[model samples]
Target chain A: MPLISQQQKAVILMADDDADDRYLVQVAFEENDIQCELLFVEDGSEVFDFLMGQGKHEEKGSKIPNLILLDLNMPKKDGKQVLQEIKALPAYHHIPVVIFTTSKSPEDVRQLYKMGASSFISKPSSFDKLSEVVRNIGTYWVETTMLP
Target chain B: MRKQTLQFLYASLAAAVLLLLSIGVFTFRSLRSLIEQSDAIAHTNKVLFQTEEVISTMKDAEIGQRGFILTHDSSFLKPYVDATQYLGRQLKLVDSLTNFRPQVVQRQRVRRLFYFAQQRDAHIKQLLAASLEPNRPDYDLRLIALLNRGKATMDSARIVVDSLQQTEKLLLEERIHHKDQLSANTLGLFTLISLLAVLMFSLAFYLLIQEIRRRQNYERQLEKTVSDLLRTNQDLEQFTYVVSHHLQEPLRKLQTFSTRLVQKHAIELGDNARFLMERMGSTANQMQTLMADLLVYTGLGLHGDTTDFEVQDLAVVFQKTVENHEKQLSAAKAMVQFDKQSWPVLGEMEQLELLFSHLLQNSLKFVVENQRPHISVHTFVITGEQMPFATQSQHDERFVKIVFTDNGIGIDMQYQDKVFGLFQRLHTADNYPGTGVGLAVCKRIVKRHNGYIHLAATEVGAAFHIYLPLAN
Candidate 1:
């Protein structure tokens, strides 16, 4: 088990097909005071590639993300398939995968959790609430939980 | 209603069948008895005819013997001999026919006739013999005496025969009367059976027509209900699609631009400008939450399919729900106690999880000031009859009763009825932070699972009771 050190910044890999949502989430993260490396992917397949150190992610070296933020509705492949694939692999199963989507549907949240998602957070429409949510996620997952 | 109609139809059909069967049996018996009575009357008439024939044949024999005595002709003797033979056979026949009757007077009269007939024949024979003997000097006188004696015997025999004939005639008349009575009774019975059958058939037909009309009424009602459901579903689908796609996108952009403006021009803007920006951001957030909840509410209406449901363990679903609300639970310092023995219910796993999550969220949100929320989830099995608001036609015989109780600010009795309504809130946003659709979503989910959920009146805190079908 690989433990994240307090001094080191954790990397959060995000997969979302929406450009505006990705940019807004990045801005929300910037507005918050959480110190973490943010990596973005436009599709679910890219999420798998980043996790496996394949394609464009190969040049970045063997740097696995400490956490994965997934979007439910993505082009090429959906977040549900990615979550299933990530949880099925023994090497990546221990990494926390949080579903961050615009869907506040309880069924989607429950389904993501049942599929081994670590957390499900609905994307807030406002920037301030989004920043607060990102800050809370950082505090809970990074500072409070002992991530492997 | 349909079941009741079908039961009534079956009952009437059975009654009609039974009535027809009884009528058939009764008519058959009556007709058979009538035929038997007619046969008895015919037999009695035959006996009367034979009795008269016996009397006439004896008289003929006596006449032929007298003829022979007067003319001294053997041809007359031949006729007498033939008549006597015929008379003997006829008397035997009459005796045989009368033997089966229980009438003692008839038997006695027949016996007297037989004896007198024998005496008449003897006298005739004696007269013939005396005439034939030429040596006898007083043959004519002897012949006359024999003739007179024969006549007296013949008269006695005729009188006996007449009595026998009278008895036979009376028997024949009585038999005819009995036959007529039997025929009339058979006809009456047949008429009664026909009338009863007609009445029963008419009653059955009337009941059948009523049942058909009732069924048609039910069909019409069902068609109206189905059409109304279809229209509502279509409207919900359109609403959900619009809310999720068209409505939320602009709201998201509003929040994004407002935050960017505050971030880039915080120094350039006045102090109140930041406050206004923050308010705008929160308002957008609130609207987004409301829209999301509305979308979920509308999505629940698309529950026409139930094939996706399976036997799911409540414990697992509860665990997922607790996990979903982990942030709030920890923030509120809520303690949730669940039973160890899991209940298996027939439902969609995701929907059940959502339902419990909403209940837990409500418990956490409605806590009294400065108090840690305490929520307990327990389950038991109950019959449909035990539920207060269950429909009589509920298909499930037994249900798993899941009770969720919390030590939170209780709902007033007056507000309990309106709590499950969409967007209905008992408290302001300052007291509790929610979209007010949590309970409504729970109710919708329960309904989708063919279950019942309601708030139980409590003095201390809110309690919700959910009744779901137990898996077979």
Candidate 2:
């Protein structure tokens, strides 16, 4: 499998309810110059709608996202519930899901992994670390593994 | 008193009672034994007197028989004749007087001897009075036959009677020995009883003294309780005076700062500054709530009012609280579910109203954004048939279970312990806004009424279980 450059990568889906947290993550990604189409949803409910080709993402031309960054705490449906729903569906089961949240609980990490999350990362407390994390995640996702 | 102290007091009192009972039993047993010894001594005396009478009758019969044979005189036969009748009477009397075996046997032997002597005297009188033929050999032969018959009979009877008399004497000696042994045993038993009585009495005395000391100690403890209460009263007074004086300074500062900020810095401040100022205002308000709750908590502990007031309808209080927070509930689009079973609880109506309102407000305030809020209220009564602690009982010290649940921004498991602390807050002021005094106030109120609160679970949302003890 040939490696795709960061610029060639398709959209990466992000789900989070906190506006400040989402803005901070976006700023970190831009500062690190980890280029890919970044698509965002406000919560797990919206994430499900986008994935299932319902609500605002019913157009078939919009490509399925290559990867997902999930936050655990959200309205309507939490990230843990979304992870469980996604893993249960055969079509979306192979798509890599990474848990990204402000919660540093070991219990949360254990639970997310148990639900078939690809990786779990605590949302970095400082901006500098968050920027570094964004760059590394981007490098690994875009330039390394072959997308299904 | 502590449970350990109460147990010690009960144990000491039981020991004292046991000691007294043991002494009483020992005294009763000793008196019974002394009466038994006196009865045994009286039995020994009767046996000895009957034996003596039998010996004297045997001696008189032997003397009279000897006098009649030696003198060949009818006048000498008088003692022998009288002896026979006397011996029969003595034997009958001895048999009636004593149960002793040897004495009765002796009396029978003496009667046999006395009868033999009388027959011999009759034969001698016949020989002396006869005036028939002078045939010497025949006469001598007759005399020999008569003499031998009388001698053999008398000798056999006398030997048996003497042996019997000796046997009776031996039995009398044995009876005296037995009496002495019984006396010794009684004395020993008496000494033992006395010793036991002394020991038991000593124990009782010691226990009595100990009881007195314990009673004194208990009195002292009561005195200490009174003194402690007095000291606690003094401390509370000092606390009220000092805390009131101290609290006024901070409150005055808060008011002064707010006034100054409004007058002088209102124009210079940005959005962040105004936001900080609003938070400051909330903190002051929270402190004021805390002080008022503390006052009520202290008052509840001090005053217990037993009144015959009927249980006020909880629905009224609920309506008033909902009306007060109607704006917030409407904004959140919250729903309230109440089980309207009238539960008559003994409590101050105002305090109960405050407790329920605070809980309801907490449920409404912490709802997840864009989610409709929900609250459920209900009453459950426990009967004696149900397992204890799990059941809520009426008019007993058993708890009235009140569970408040909400699907909100749930607290983490680690922060559960800190929820009821005076100023413990998990979220930053930028996110969820609270002064962290509400749970503390709830804790104080619950504790004042001898109730308890605990965070039941936080799996997806928060659940708080409050248990209030029902009054008997």
Top candidate (TM-score): 1
Task: Note the residue pairs that clash in candidate 1.
Answer: none
Best by lDDT: 1
C-alpha lDDT (0 to 100) for residue B342 of candidate 1: 79
Interface-residue RMSD per candidate?
A: 1.8, 16.5
Q: What is the DockQ of candidate 1?
A: 0.36
Q: How do the residues B310-343 of candidate 2 rate in per-residue lDDT, one tens digit apiece? A: 3545556566677778898888888887776555
- Candidate 1 on B183-241: residue-level lDDT in tens? 78877877776777777677778878987788899999999999999898788687776
Highest DockQ: which candidate?
1
- Residue B271 of model 1, lDDT score: 95
CA lDDT of B354 in candidate 2?
A: 68
TM-score of 1: 0.60
Clashes of 1: 0
Off by over 4 Å in 1: A1-148, B1-122, B125-129, B144-231, B258-281, B300-304, B323-327, B382-398
Q: Model 1: which docking level applies?
A: acceptable
Give the worst 10-residue stretch by lDDT in candidate 1 chain A: A1-10
